[model samples]
Target: MIASYEMKHQVPYYECDATGHQTLAMLFRLLILASEDHSDALGVGTAKIKEYDGGWVIINYAGDVDRLPRENETVTIKTYVEAYNRFFVVRTFEVYDADGKQLVKVKGMFAFMNLTTRKVASIPEPLIVPYQSEESRRLPKVARPQLMANDLAWERLDYRVRFFDIDLNNHVNNAVYFDWLLDPLGGEFLRHHRLVNLKMKYDHEVRAGEKVDSQFIKIEEKNQIITHHQIQCQGKIAAEAEFEWKLV
Candidate 1:
């Protein structure tokens, strides 16, 4: 059996931002879809997870984008299980253009959680064995995003958890967090810049009817702009992210 899986996709207009290129959030969504496809091929996908009453949750994700796919462009996404421990699995992804030039590289860490308790659970052997991934004492890790200081003058926006934002898991979908994080930057900034690198840590989940406050602080370094974001629910942090953007 092949250790990796790949899929071809055409960049859709709805997935692109004002810059006419795929948004960072859409890239993340695509990576997730690819992972789901891989898991389904291995016989351990959504249906199996439901049978186990467990779901996979991303603990952290980090990626670097060399180029963003433009609207209507055809691209390929390749993904594989990099490594796994007793509690967490590490997966990696690469996006390539039609010419085979890589556009993005991504790494994600995920843990299985029991739906009832919402706590980490041991991965089933049957599920783990199918991936044929390496078992390691130390799996790859992404740095946790730091909290934005209260003293910093940060821009903030509030969003209600809409029905559309909820996924099958019944919580705000992880991909929606990217919109909450970047939309506060406004169209002007997004039009003039492109996301180059991003790292995010999900600390808490936002449920429907909850109001989430998205805040961020921008730091200019050399030719790049780095932004730190914090999403809070009821004054408690739900997620944190760090983004690096380059001038267009």
Candidate 2:
């Protein structure tokens, strides 16, 4: 029985960037691994998801990193179920330093989807039972993106379409957008506060050869920062989004 699994991990050198800190993309990957571990513990790993003719697909995710894990540092990821809606489940992650202090917190919304049909499906009862926890509480109210905000404006950020960014979906991978957004801020912000939250709204498809603009709106009262990405052809908002970043 994988009761309350724990694993120690040393940050790999390759996962670090020029600043000698773990890359945002790599951090996301680590969290994915932790989630898989949780599935294994509950005996509902990916194979079981497939067995039910259903699979888990990330619909939306918001996370905040408080500090960047340096090279060779051992960090622990503790995760648990926060809540579940009819079509979506909210999972949370807490990353800790070797000393056990919290470093990063991630919350994601996942949908049970029919792989073949590529559509949302009702979560199976057996699947949900094991994942549920008596201590699991309702997730905190998150500030969602506003499709239209008067204070928000789009700033064009041009990215050359790269062959590698295209995933099996034939579109830019969702995680790649984080690189685009976080890279602009440089490693300073990432190195400072651990990411406590990140909200991403994929408004439209990003294809090769298309230039895009990322927009931002500051909502300090809520300790939240919002951003948008748009595909610009002749300077029009083809796609738009707002993201909330909460400080840990």
Candidate 3:
């Protein structure tokens, strides 16, 4: 079994939401940071992967959140490579409060992309061996985002992909999609709702200067509110996501 790596962090005001708790975007970034640090520890960091003309790209993220950590609240993050196949890897992250309560649990599917061609590539042994993750021929299927029940109600917003959105590998960072996905809900709904769960998938890359259409619709039920989002660029679906929320 592969060993898990952990780090502690104190929430900062800059990463928090209006409610003082960390925003979902920040939460996602923390997970990325944890994974990067872990990769460095195992000698398979981004710099090393770049040497092979490739970079890791997130394909999907599915998770549950009990609550978000507030400003100045310290939390522990643990992450590890869970499994891998010929072309994909599965990793998980767990966040805990000072009291040892699990605050967030997330699992992500990732694939390696050839930097030169921007196409999916087979996993490199140098990158996967150090992590000691179990090599499997098959992996479990992740939940997919569902179509909006009512398309006419979707609120749409148009955004131009910014230069800053592109990372070192010349693609929009996956974390940035959280902003595009959530912003369509408007400030009023965002401030009043707390995210409890999320399921997001990337179907295509959104390159710089491309115009993207972010659309979503909210479905409120007795127990929870559900929002389905889709991002389109160049006349194709770039991504899709669904989020579960409760009133704050």
Candidate 4:
């Protein structure tokens, strides 16, 4: 059986929103940190992977959030290898509140990439050997999210990718995408709506100094709301996302 890794964190004020709830960006940052720690423990940290000319890139995130932890709440973060193929690995993450209640669950799909060529590459044995996850030729795919209706009016905002947006590997990190995706929604809309489900896919990497156009459309249904977002750079989509929210 594949063993899981766990870490604990105390939600600090900076990671929380003005209302004292954990921000979605910070929640994901916590997951990424936990995963990195897991890799360090497994002996194949970033430096080790670079020895094989490979870099881990997360391409998809599918998840649901029960609630965001409040500021100062202690939470447990855990992740385990779910499955893998010749080219991809899926890892599952969960966060539990102080009372042990599940607060968030996410499945992240990762691809081993050639850092030089910036292309997806075959999984290296040294990398897969440690996980011991079930190997499959065909892994289930995340559903294609409901698309935004182009006929309807949409809101857009533009951001210049700053140097800080790039990670050590010189690629845009995950947190900046959240800022681009949700910033178009005015505070009045965001403060009253709570995200419940989300599906996001990263298709292209946005580098430093690039201009990104973020577009979002809101669809309202009975007591629930759905938002479709597209992050495009130079007319090519860098990321696509769909989020479900409920009015509080």
Error of 2 at 104 (Å): 0.5
Which is the better candidate, 1 or 2, if ranked by TM-score?
A: 1
The all-Cα superposition gives candidate 4 an RMSD in Å to the true structure of 1.4
lDDT per residue (tens digit) for residues 1-248 in model 4: 88689999999899987667988888888899999899889998888998989988888898898888899999999998888899999889999987899999989899999988989999888887777678877876654456666667878999998888898767788878988898898788888888899898888889887999999988888877899999889889898999999886
What's the C-alpha lDDT at position 183 in model 4?
A: 81
Estimated TM-score for each candidate: 0.96, 0.73, 0.93, 0.95
Give one digit per residue, the lDDT tens place, for model 1 in 177-209: 999999999999988887888899999999999
Best candidate, lDDT: 1
Q: What is the C-alpha local distance difference test score of candidate 1?
A: 0.90
Off by over 4 Å in 1: none
Model 2 RMSD in angstroms = 4.7
For model 4, the local distance difference test gives 0.87
lDDT score for residue 231 of model 1 = 93
Alpha carbon deviation, residue 133, candidate 1 (Å):
0.9
Off by over 4 Å in 4: 149-151
Superior candidate under TM-score, 1 versus 4: 1
lDDT of 3 by residue, 1-248 (tens): 79689999999899987778898888898999999999999899988998999988888999899998899999999999899998999999999999999999989999999989989999889889988888888876667788655446778999888999998757787888888998888889988888898899999988877889999987878877999999989988999999999898
Q: In candidate 3, list every pair of residues with a backbone clash.
A: none
Alpha-carbon runs more than 4 Å astray in model 2? 1-5, 134-142, 145-153, 166-172, 184-197, 203-248
Q: Which of the two candidates, 1 or 4, achieves a greater lDDT against the reference? A: 1
